[model samples]
Target: MSREKGKEFAEQDLTPMTGAATDVAPLGRQQKPAHELTADEDIDVADWDRVAAMAEFKQLVLAKRKFILPATIFFVVYYFALPALVGYAPGLMSKRVFGVVNVAYLFALSQFFMAWLIAALYVRAANRFDGMAQRIISKLKGGR
Candidate 1:
């Protein structure tokens, strides 16, 4: 597009991100309920109690807990280990593996990669979760 068109395009409103806490909507954005913005497929009409009580739903929740609990614990431990080691084991953290770069720097940098890896893993796991959820929806819709 031309520069002026691009500028005009950039001036257009974007959707307000869901879950943001603010009295006023942010500039160039409008707040809309999720149900209004996306195809529902009657997702909002599912009976909460029945859905929660289903064996598949129970399994799905369990799967999430199993994966999430450990990942959270590991991430927390790994994340805080940096500061803990720096404070408690300064000598170890200070040991230089490469010239001018020490263990502390390397470990800190690894946090970025670690976060990305966890995100990638979660995406894979989320696909399975989505499939489980869809199956439960189908069963609820009498497609079983």
Candidate 2:
């Protein structure tokens, strides 16, 4: 298309399908300019530093580390155990279960379930972590 036509298209008012004039901003909702955005207005660095240094924060971090490190180690071991077993003992892995279905296939399939269970557990733990974090924020804000 021509530059003028393109410019016209760009400048065209996008009316709703109902053909009624709406209060919505043209082209879409108006957004605040980056410089005008005050997303960090309530965040005090000193308060954040103080909260980070608190024993509560340290406990929170340690708690997360304790859970996550062990969980990660467990998952890694569990995930790799299948391959190691298959490689080391192909005869055992090849053994039939119900008709043609083998042990290896069942074990591989179980990995999917294991991953989903881990994710669910992580979500539950994360909810607790969120509560801890909120408490820390509240303490910093002098609300607790």
Candidate 3:
């Protein structure tokens, strides 16, 4: 509305416009103050560096690299190959597949399916990674 009305509304709003409301807890649950919450936690802030250096963490990194690197390489190659084929091997790519759909067009369309397939595969692999990460964190926390 008017600038004065806007200013009045802004003044009436109790919530801060920026940054998270640290005082509020979920579902109307009463939370301890920030300092108290940090003090009561079992994790030591100093040990975070040590946790990152742990063998379990290294294994997690290696596992992710193993899956992600190959998937990335594969997708990059497949995605580029379509255009490369169209440019370099135009005759081959121009060959009709269905009625008017050429090999190049089919290959380009298959990229969408390839992307979805890669995403699905990554999600499956990431679930395993999540389990590994949780185990590593649990070990670091001196739990199960």
Candidate 4:
């Protein structure tokens, strides 16, 4: 509405500040016993058992790596390829359509397209990889 009303609303007190400026309270540093909290208890196990548990996790990691490597390569290639194309093709990207926005600039901006592309690929890959890992884990853990 009016500027003064807006200013007044903006200047309104939000929350109670704790103590003086020098007496700053630690934010979210509260300590509580494990049983007192709702969070799941951290299970303690031997290193060997941890390693054994990670066997399926290792396979999942490998599968993820497979996707990441290819996606990363594609992302890099796509990001740089437009600049290269513009470099080699002079005025190719300089063709202005709607105001100063040029084809080259738009092509460069298409890096977002590559990002989405890579993200989609990674998601699909991870899903498949996770499914495989789940199967393996279920078999190993006796249909868990």
Question: Per-model C-alpha lDDT, please?
Answer: 0.74, 0.72, 0.72, 0.61
**Steric overlap count per candidate:** 0, 0, 0, 1
lDDT of the structure predicted as candidate 3? 0.72
Error of 3 at 91 (Å): 0.9
Ten consecutive residues with minimal summed lDDT in candidate 2?
1-10
Q: List model 1 lDDT by residue over 1-144, tens digit each.
A: 122332333343322345646444345555344444456432333345555767999999999999899999999999999999999999999999999899999999999999999999999999999999888766655523
What pairs collide in candidate 2? none
C-alpha TM-scores of all predictions = 0.67, 0.65, 0.67, 0.47
Residue-level lDDT of model 4, residues 2-25, one tens digit each, is 223323323433222334455533
lDDT tens readout by residue for model 3, 1-144: 122332333334322233356544335545444343455553232244554677888899999999999999999999999889989999999999899989988999999999999999999999999999878756644422
Better of 3 and 4 by TM-score: 3
> What lDDT score is found at residue 40 in candidate 3?
55
Ranked by lDDT, the better of candidates 1 and 4 is 1
For all predictions, the C-alpha RMSD in Å is 14.8, 14.8, 15.1, 18.7
Q: Pairing residues by index, what is the TM-score of model 4?
A: 0.47
Best by lDDT: 1
| Candidate 1 vs. true structure, TM-score | 0.67
- Superposed by TM-score, candidate 1 places the C-alpha of residue 45 at a distance from the truth, in angstroms, of 3.3
